[model samples]
Target: MRLTWIHPEDLIGHELRQARQDGRAVEAIARRWHDAGGHDAPPMAGASPEPAPERLRRLAEDLLDELATIPSPLADREPTGLDAVISACPDWPGAPLAAPGPDLAGRLRGAWAGRAAGCVLGKPVEKIPREGIRAIAEATGNWPIRGWFTARGLPDDVAERWPWNRRSAPTSLAENIDGTPEDDDLNFPMLALALLERYGTGFGTDDVAQMWLDELPAGRIFTAERVALRNLLVGLASPETAVYRNPFREWIGALIRADVYGWVNPGDPARAAVLAHRDAALSHTANGVYGAMFAAALAAMSLTANGPEEVLAGALRVVPPESRLAVAVREAADLARAEGDFERVLDALHARHADLHWVHSVNNAAAVAAALVHGAGDFSASVTSVVSAGWDTDSDGATVGSVAGGLLGADGIPDQWTAPLHNRVASTLTGFNGATFDTLAARTHALVQETSG
Candidate 1:
């Protein structure tokens, strides 16, 4: 059977027409776009008629007004650490031992497990409705399929299944089910794997930056904001031109790609945060950089400890206390304490901030909160909460999952999640392969040893 693929632009146009037929104004359309992290469409070159700036501005205002009215449930509270269950686990690994040694391998493994946990948590709920997600959690006795890994290994049927794209229907823009090209080009775990494979221990900051630049297609250029941020890093020259400015939210994908920096640094969460911040500043600003710092710090801490709460605390210390991301995480934790229902908090958040762009500080802030609170040291729950919450599902899932996987270690991941995936992941970008998660984890461990030594 031949497959039919519909372009995103066509889908957008169809939605707009349907909304218009239903008597919805352009403002409503604009609001939906903003909520989905989209900006106004750029004018097509050589078009004779163009939208008047004043008209577009009015549409933008209407959309903004509609957005301002929606209230988010978990937007107001302060950042709280994981619950007593996670804090009290006797087996929870503590902070890494100081300095250069073999212990780093264990830490890296923990961080990898954390990442895996995040992925597993989000995987099942990637595009499922909120109600459906809640129902699944209730039925499974686990909010997002947590902790089923047996040291003895997988059941025969599951172990024999081959990993490949199984979805049979056309995809919606909101749901890139099979992780096609249209999905965001880079995710945290994939980027970490790439960095480790490419830079390894011998490359310094400059070499890493150059390699990243080289990796991009020749016709594509880094934005001025990215350049400015890159200049802030170690060994990169600070350009006098000032031509570059920060992209802030638009470059979040690039910012979260800093986990490898932390992985390389091992026990030095602070250093990892610094390197992540410097790298992130090249393409992002404010919370964008902080998100990278948070992920990187967790990855770094994971190198030394398996305690999710402690690793999270280490990450929190690195970001600015007053930032929106910090505020959102704290609020989510508080909501988790006061309200037992995770969906209610998510509802509240949507009501308050649904109009905000998906990549904006507030949106990403909610993602962080969802991952930290829902996951609460349980790998699956964390990933599920964030991914099911929607918005940037893959990006959030990848980051949170990677961090959780790192903390939990590969051995801790349930066979169910990994068994179906068979450790395969794909990116059109070079220097990556469709390898098993075990192989990737082992390679990552080796890289840490090489870098720290």
Candidate 2:
């Protein structure tokens, strides 16, 4: 009975760590866990299956409850509510007045295809570190990630040392890819699309919760979304589902679901952020919510942006200027612009955010921004650069692909990247399995017209 992500004992250890990062004083709580013979939580990426004794489990549950109520010192500056978030950003860009252009369909098509291509590219190495990724890729002659990873000539030692992510390798490799395989990175955007179609852009948080129960498979969701699913099943409501016993509230789950919001609200970052806020509020808080807003804003701007620098600057306007996530993006973008080499920029970012979990919103968002800034509007360069940085590779690649794709349009992305997808994608959602990206783009474009009108 040791479910890896949700076991109360395991969750308490992670919650303690999360609280401390939020500037909450948790020294006494850490001492209590140590006194109780509990080890610190395993790294967020590792699996631990040994069941805790009953006493420890109860203590863990009680501690999680206590942790939820403790206020972080940064709370006021990092408010989660949409209005408060907008208020915190003094230079906030009001909603863009520009409408989607005649080429909207092509841009949307590029975004969908680009997202799938980039996601597929990073899948095989999702959890491997930067050095390991480099080692494996260099060994296979794919270093700098010019294309999908391969085992064709990888050394046995390199293969053993940096094994491909088990679930991703069989389907995501260059030789094995048929159509895009089902991945949470792509699934969430599909879910967002379904949500808009069902409830329109004005859908509430409850609507988001209900949609998951109806369409999103419980097993497919993870981390914060998993906790929120559990909360919803037990009858806990919207905003509460995001916080109760949910230490993963600030992780990157919300960020990945942001693209459809931006897609439908093309050229309007402020409105895109508001829609993203509604969706993100169901499972995330603080910087987690901000991460979604940032991505949605970026994606929205990409439809009309002249280049990556414009996309980054316009997106930054939606995030709270003083929030840690904002500071990280600004620093990452600044360093990328100044240094001009992605590897050096990544090293600086990795060292600066070493204390963060691999899936945390702040670090992953920083990496995405750095990639876009460094890539400077080249579709191949942007997606490849982000995946190479190694934190949440698939997710970062998908977001970077999305923004860059929207900017470049379908005709601009290289055929090498788009051809493998066969214009198709797979999903666990009811109507999306084997759906073509162009069809999805048409459907999404229809919404853009509807919403804009």
Write candidate 2's Cα lDDT for 191-290 as tens digits: 9998999999989999999999998887778899998999999999989999988888999999999999999988788899999999999999999999
Q: What TM-score would every model get versus the actual structure?
A: 0.60, 0.98
Candidate 1, run of 10 with poorest lDDT = 2-11
- State the lDDT of candidate 1 residue by residue for 186-298, as single tens digits: 33445556655766544444544565565544222233233433444434442221112222232344444777777776667766766665555444444555667777776
Q: What are the candidates' C-alpha RMSDs?
A: 11.6, 1.1
Candidate 2: lDDT of 23?
A: 94
Q: Show where candidate 1 strays beyond 4 Å.
A: 1-209, 217-251
lDDT of each: 0.49, 0.90
Q: Who wins the TM-score comparison?
A: 2
Model 1 TM-score is 0.60
